[model samples]
Target: MFNTIEHINKENRNWLKSFYFIHKLSFRTLWARKASWVGTFIFSCCLLILFPFGLGTEALQRADIQIGTFWIMNEFVAVLTISRIFSAEQECNGMDLILTSKLQKTSIIAGKISFTAFQIFTLQIPILLLWIIFYNINSNILVNLLNNLFFVSIFFNLGSASLGTLITCLTARSLAKEILLPMLFFPLQSGILLASVSLTIHIGNNSLLGAFSESAWWTILIAYPIIFSTLGILLSDLLLQE
Candidate 1:
């Protein structure tokens, strides 16, 4: 019994160390390549600026339009960039290095998801600020706007992040991954995308915190992240194996 307990504790310690190592590595990898995503963010800003033309300046001046535009840009950017999370590893054969090492597969997946989710959030920040400026969002709406943005990013990102990992691992070695990723990812994303959009629309109508609690948004927000993140986490080992 003592030996079993000792073995379990050692395994836990090694797992925790591997987790932190991979997490730190994810940050380092993205930071070194930060310009790639930052450029994407700038591109999004330009796209949002042009949006007033098609959406109509007056129509986009509405609070709902502003909020919707922010998340819609996020959804678009995520779809475009999600493949890169693992593509880097595959491109350089980093996966083989990892595979031969003692690192846990789930830890690597968690790190990728963490980095992707955080990247998605970073991508939204500039667009969201531009959103507020363009819409002339009042001080009264600021708190609720930020609140919903924060939570919705979390919920929306959970699903996207997981989907990002699942697709990356599944397609890491594929010759057609660039073409295949969006096809695979967007379908998994549609339900969460639709849910978050509905939730955003409800929030746009303004009932503050009460609006979230009163509608199906809360359930949809809570359920999707849990379901998708779990699926990604549980299947990661199988997905990453040689």
Candidate 2:
């Protein structure tokens, strides 16, 4: 019994080390490519700027319309980020090094998904602030709305990022991966997007408790990450074998 417990604890510690190693690798690689993140930040700002002109400023101020537009912009960002999963490694055969090491494949996929999700969430923060500035939200509701938006953004990004990581890995070796990535990604992600939008609209109008009370929306928001993250971890070894 004592040996079994020690073995399990050792395994847990190793898994965490592997997870952090992969995450750190991704961070350094992405940070080296400043153009990618800089371009994405510019793209996000441009979207926010042009959207009002297309929708007309008056319509853009309407809560539902603006919220929906913001989410759609995030969807685009998710596609761009997720499409690049495993890309850095592919360029340098870094993935081969990782596979050849004793690092856990499950930890590897989790780390990649987490990094992508965290990047998306961080990028969205400025966009969210810009959104508040652009729409000139009522000062009274500003804090409350921001709180709700933050909550939704966390799960929304996680769910999309989780599934996107899996699909991106699966198609990483394909000749037309760029084309295939978005095609496979958007359809899978649409349900989560809708749930996020709906929750945003609800919480914008009501309170956080009110949004959670709507069980269907809440279920999707909660379940999406759990379901897809599991699939990603389970299939990662098989997918990465290629």
Candidate 3:
């Protein structure tokens, strides 16, 4: 079903070829499940519209809810998309073929992370816009918010991909896959969410006081991607044990 690599150089050459193959497959598979992501997108938008009605329009209330809701929605989107990432391979019976292919596990992890971030970024774009529109946030802060989201998404997606990959691989053969993903994911993710939400609120309030200005939060933003992605790359090979 596959060609043998006759030379070391040829093997190296084909690794990237395999990576791109998986990369494109990952992106295409994400969009193929558009209904799932679309439902989350529409649901988030509705929640944004209804938040003010449910929580009152006071500035303090809006500020608190804006950052909290946006971050949760982003995290939720990551879970919704990423939880299914590995399951897609298992569901199609391609897990064995993929793990045994010419591609290195790190290459597979890189390809998967690239596409996962891409999907999350695309989904968050409209949600961000809706957040600004519905919350009456300052228009001038739009660029700032996007900049923050850019960094936060990188950190969040890295952690999400790591946890998602780990959990999915471990739970792929489990009878209660859905129940296990979130149970394991949210606990590992709480720190990232806390830091992201605080930083976002600081950006909105036009102040960098307290937790937002703390170096610890910045470290988390910088370290999360590096740590989680590195871990994912390292631990990704463990999937073969299953």
Candidate number with greatest lDDT: 2
Sorting all predicted structures by TM-score, with the top scorer first, yields 2, 1, 3
What is the C-alpha RMSD, rounded to one decimal, of candidate 1? 3.0
Off by over 4 Å in 3: 1-12, 59-61, 206-213
Summing lDDT over every window of 10 consecutive residues in candidate 1, give the lowest-scoring window: 206-215
Clashing residue pairs for model 2: none
For candidate 1, lDDT tens digit of each residue in 1-242? 99999999998888778778766766666567776587778778877778889898888767677777777788777875675676566556776777789888777777777778877877777778887787677677788767876887787887788878888788876889888888888887876776677666666775433344435666766787677667777997788887
**Candidate 3: residue 182 lDDT (0-100):** 87
Cα lDDT, model 1, residue 132: 76
Q: TM-score for every candidate vs. truth? A: 0.88, 0.93, 0.84
lDDT of 1 at 69: 78
Pairs with backbone N, CA or C atoms under 3 Å apart (clashes), candidate 3: none
Write down the lDDT that model 2 would get: 0.82
Predicted structure 1: lDDT: 0.74
Model 2 bad stretches (over 4 Å): 205-213
Candidate 1, after superposition: displacement of residue 98 in Å?
1.0
In candidate 1, how many Å is residue 22 off?
Answer: 1.9
Residue 170 accuracy (lDDT) in model 3: 73
lDDT of 2 by residue, 99-136 (tens): 89999889998998899999898788888889878877
User: Lowest summed lDDT over 10 consecutive residues: which window, candidate 3?
Assistant: 206-215
